[model samples]
Target chain A: MAEIELPAGIMPDYRQQLPKFLKDYAGRWIGHAEVRPGVLKHWADDGQTCYTVRILLPPNGLLSAATVRRLAGWIRKYALTGRRTCRQSFELVGVAPDKIEELIAEVKASGLVVGGTGATWHQIKCCTSFVHCQNAAIDAPSIAKVLSDMLLALEEQKFPAPLKISVGGCPNQCGGGTDADIGITGVFRDPPQVDEEKLLAANEDIGLLISWCPTAAIRPKPLPEGMAVEINPARCVRCSSCAQVAPGGVSMGRERGAALSVGGQGGNSRGGPQMGAVIFPFLPAEPPDYALLKERVHSIIAYWLHEARPGEKIGSLAKRLGWGRFLAGVGVEDIESLIDDYYPARTVRRNLHFKF
Target chain B: MKAEWQELPLCRQLMQGLYPSHVAELSQTRYPLQMYEEGLKKGVSAYDYGGYISIPEIPSGAGVRTSRRPDILPESPYLRVLGPAGGWLSADTLERLADCAEKYGNGLIHLANGGTIELYAAREKLVPLVRELNSFGLDVGSTGDDLRCLTSCCGPARCDLALVDAPALATYLGQRFIDDQQYPGFPQKCKSAVAGCPNDCIRAMMQKDHSFIGVFRDLPVINNEEFKSWLAEGGDPERLVNGCPEKALKWDGHELFLDGDTCVRCMFCINNCPAIRPGRERGVAWVVGGKYGHRGPQGPMVGYVLVPFIPLTGEEGFVYLGDIFAAFLELWSEHGRRKERIGDFVARFGPRRILRALGLKAEPQILLWPKNNAFANKQGRRGGEGNGGN
Candidate 1:
């Protein structure tokens, strides 16, 4: 192939343009290490061999500008290009094997992990929780950091299969947690608090508030000054619609925590893929360690590790073993509270076992 | 035993050269074969063989046919291909896919109902065809039970009603969960989607097992100038004023004012009028348990508003959402019964229990039906509430 000449007065030097520390690490490979095969081999359009280096980002998918700049530097130094993988990792293509080690070392020096592939815990993914989100009830990154620390050691351990754990700061699981090996989401227990004064000031459109509520949780009460809306705490899901519709008139309550679900595997298997189900209704968000929450998760994983057959995903194993046995194996004491069959049995009568 | 339509010429024609030969032979021995033959002869498409073909007694991976069309001697079986999130494909990619379709399969490409692409190819050609497609950076999957493509509406990219970047979020999710799209290892298929705002052009809440709907945390921002201009352009002021579900809009002949407290932000007004727009404070509402199929217990249900909102901003936003998705997938995979959709699972186990396990407070918004006492008067309160009576 003929090389195309660039017509430029001055091309930006991205590598030399980097800071001294980043420049020093250029062309060096910082190995984060992978238990499973991380190398990807593909042919270019010209049929030339191309090598791509994959590196796992730390849990929560946050990367500093310095790290990104160094990555860019590495890409520039190697004359390679980069793209992000679906698993929240970066893949730098067109690197030779001779420079792989150095490149990995350089990336490591930049404080980024290099492995999140194969039959171990992958990079922990999360949504913006309390940090930047106005609707988040718990600090999602804090929980993710703790979980990452707990599971990162296992990234190198060969398990029955690869596992993905996703966390949503709130129930609106932007992280795709519903279809992972494990999913965690924050929750709010109380209804939004109604600022009667604000409601009065905002024109107290009581009828609008009542009609907008998905669940008829808001009711208009005659106030001495003007109309005020009262939330039926029993019926409120705390979806924040009222607050959205009437901004200053309503606000989220103080009570907040997290929820845990398990066995959500997405692959073409026996019955296609399945959405994860909640194993625990609610676990108080105990920061730093999150002891009780971690224990339950650990117990579920332990049971699956011991009992699951080869090539069996957590969802498939749960099905094969029966939900009752699976719950028992996980050391769940109140199984009845967690599992109920009446509703499903009554509703889906035709093609009950129909596979997609 | 039945002679009503057996002797008819239409029935004879229908029986002649039926694609699946076994059904032809079974006609002689089966009891209801005559009824099926009658229906087929009466112009009911042979593909509409619904009740006659029984579902498998046990859920098995084998013999699963995605399309209703039978493969004849020269025709190839159908293969499903997944489209990019929001069904947005670049022209170059489309050209490649079109070339692959023409070369590998019958000269046709189908956009499936689940927001995926389909190509009809010989069974033998599937592997190689997929390989060819892989070269173009596209893959075939979303057939069996697994996470299908994550769909979204054109957010700020094209539509003015959008509150958040729907396509960006969808693409983010598509890239983040690409493996799940290719692999089918769950009890059943799972669908997910994102909508830029409450307009929900993509029907995320009803068709997807997991849905993220864009929402505003504050009241809709009304541009007085735009409102006045709209009024001048023959925008029916009386209709707009009386159209508010909560009667929140007031028109003083020349100007319009919004009663923020009374507005429900259902997007009706915004949808109706071009001048009014959603507020600046935007985020996503996580709704779960939605599915279109009726095979599950909760037959064709709309998702429950699981979380009122989760703000999408920066890298932390993506991380927080990813973590939550992973956790729920694990929980459902561990306990959900065979062929149980997340919606049915939520219905059976109850959203409260699901929320409890996830450490979410059980709020009234998750309830499928309003409580009987929702409108009932409190014991200590008189009828003066909201009445504005002295």
Candidate 2:
């Protein structure tokens, strides 16, 4: 093999010097990098070095063809490759160490933020609530954008630990909000409106519809026209299962809102992974401002910042301080309906009833 | 400590089966104290060892955790090999995997519950093992909070009950989202699966975050001749009629009649008798938010059907489903909190707003019908009261 010589303090122009196969192989390379104050570096398995350039994207995860083309050009120029990061950011690899500042500036010039690492807020994730999902009960992306903008400053401000906020349009939780430090999901306060005529026309079996309800909210009715499905308003959990099972027969109620959960984390660290608990179950879906929801989220974050120990996640912190004290610190007064201690145990011996 | 089976009631009961009068002699021979003493001499402690040895690490990707079994000798790391959809592995691939396991691991391959193959190897051999796996057009993943391998049930390839090509759809999805599987980027792990029919042998609707289940829009087609023959061959007509959940099936001596209006299409009748099969019109229903793990907010839950029916006809059908999936991924990735699962996300966010964002109209199919308030006027009043309560 010919010994290819490279200039000192500079990276070789691999796009020109390396064979197409090697370049293609490099393009398929996938990995992670540690970002310092203003520099990023990732190493390959063979001890190859590459500088990282981060490109933060919108919560909707849409990138224009033009933006992708421009990014490709930058990758070609640096004789590097790009991989999409888990936090919805694109990291350009194999950039020359000297070109870090240049690449950052170039990416910034194209109206993209270039920071999503360290103790700061990594990325906000939203589910396809009401966007393209037939099951969505709320507008997830819009709320996500709003929340992202609200917490934009935190993206650069280094926290004691990483902070993540997720939003889902409904309880399906495509956003995985249950495992985030701060999680938000949409909710419905009422049952679906049933059209008897449509229900009969669709040949929907009332028995199946009744069985589909998770909350036992559905029942069959003998109307003058025929058999129709009805919902028990008090019993309905608003899971939307009935509507999904019988499309034309049932529809979502008019009253829709958002719910807030806290202290969820996903990792193999202390306390393991945890799902978020509902701190506030009903925040009306008032858009553009969502003032109530924002205030509550901010309060939780503020309390976490004040109380959490360094390197401790929100879930762990919640466990350490006790959920009651944590709620008190966050100034959440309503606790009657709080469902923090209801995880179903694997083995419940119904027979063991001890008289206390 | 004493050899007295006569004194110990449990030992007497055990000896009653075989020893009878020789219970004392058998008890003397079984020296539990001596065995414990020997174990102690061999460095075996009565207490379980809880700590683990730190091993040298390699970065496969973000969120991938190398599992360690300290109890086993050599402390081999367990690597999950992403398999083809529906757990189908060709002989060549299996042979290569076996060879790799023999050369680099403990020569043991464990088929995991998550539909992936596990290879127990040394930590140092993982990267090279993965590299070799890549050469065979296979990779290792589904370890951490990323998209796990797309699983499926045997579809039209083998099962007559299959309404769609589940394996093919899974393969397509696996290929399309290979990056999502290889790269751990989500707040938490996202799992997906495809089932060919409502039978759902893979349990996709209960175990996966997102599941595409085969559904028949129309009624089940009953072959009268086949039904008659089945009936003549001891297939009880009364049993089949009663098996219908809605009591839609009626047998009048010679022939069977189905009341299509009352049929719920739960597949009970079809599953009971082979003579009846799913209708010609087939589609898939998208279900979301299912999870078996109880870590999150709502605890363990079965998925809710999101879309009642999405017609799967041709390339356009795949594209339509793909577009919906892509949209979901984008939304969840961009806005989801770190480590949040889709189910928990939906719980926090109301489904109404999600549907609005997706540009989907509010469909009646996604709502729960009230069982008690059957009368329209009563329901209207109750609904009004419920709104006021909110």
DockQ for every model, please: 0.01, 0.01
User: What are the lDDT figures for the candidates, one per model?
Assistant: 0.57, 0.60
The candidate that wins on lDDT is 2
Give a tens-digit lDDT track for model 2, residues B59-154: 222121211222323222556666666554333444566577667764544344455656656567776877676677666666566788777774
Tens digits of per-residue lDDT, candidate 2, A260-334, equal 888765431233235667778888766434677778877777777777765556776777787677878888789
lDDT at A283 for candidate 2? Answer: 80
First chain of model 2: TM-score? Answer: 0.81
How does candidate 1 fare on TM-score? 0.45
lDDT of 1 by residue, A13-113 (tens): 12221224322322122111232255544332233444557666543433332334455677766525554433445566556767877887777665565
Assess the local accuracy of residue B133 in candidate 2 as a C-alpha lDDT between 0 and 100: 67
lDDT of candidate 1 over B1-390, digit per residue (tens): 444554644334323321111122223321223433332332221222111111222111111222123331212255556555544433344455556665775444444345555565555666677667656566555645677777676344224556666656766666666666655677667888878777575657756898788888788777789777777766777766655657888888766788898776777566546567677777888888775332343444567787777787543576677667777776677667655678876666555556655666655544557655656332212333212111
